[model samples]
Target: MKYSKIFQYAYIVFAVLFIYDAISKYMSNGDIYYPSILLAALAIFIFFFRKRFSKKFDNRDNSK
Candidate 1:
């Protein structure tokens, strides 16, 4: 569980890195970097999704 929590925050860190890379590329040549943007979005979505899933798992365990 401790490692899982760490990985969850790692997703956000990766998302920020992806977003920064996308912005830097755009600034350099004025073209949209779709893949980086997509990856960042996916990372953010996964972070929230995993958090919700973990909460549900914890609740189920507590109920049992």
Candidate 2:
């Protein structure tokens, strides 16, 4: 459970890294990397989804 929480926040870290990579690449060649942008978007979505899921899980656990 602890590890799951840790990994949830790790998604934010990975999103930051992906955004940085996109910015650096754009600065270097003035080209957009769709994959990096997509991954960043996906990471953000996953982070929020995980957060909501965890909250529901906790609520369920508490009700038991």
Most accurate candidate by lDDT? 1
lDDT per residue for candidate 1 within 1-64, as digits (tens), equals 8888899999999999999999999999999999999999999999999999989988999999
Task: Put down candidate 2 lDDT per residue, 1-64, tens digits, no spaces.
Answer: 9998999999999999999999999999999988899999999999999999999999999999
Which residue pairs in candidate 2 have backbone atoms (N, alpha carbon, C) closer than 3 angstroms, thus clashing? Answer: none
> What's the lDDT of the predicted structure labeled candidate 1?
0.97
TM-score of each: 0.95, 0.97
lDDT of each: 0.97, 0.96
- Which residue pairs overlap in candidate 1's backbone? none
Best of the candidates, TM-score: 2
Candidate 2 whole-model C-alpha lDDT, 0 to 1: 0.96
Which stretch of 10 consecutive residues in model 2 shows the poorest summed lDDT?
A: 32-41
Clash tally for model 1: 0
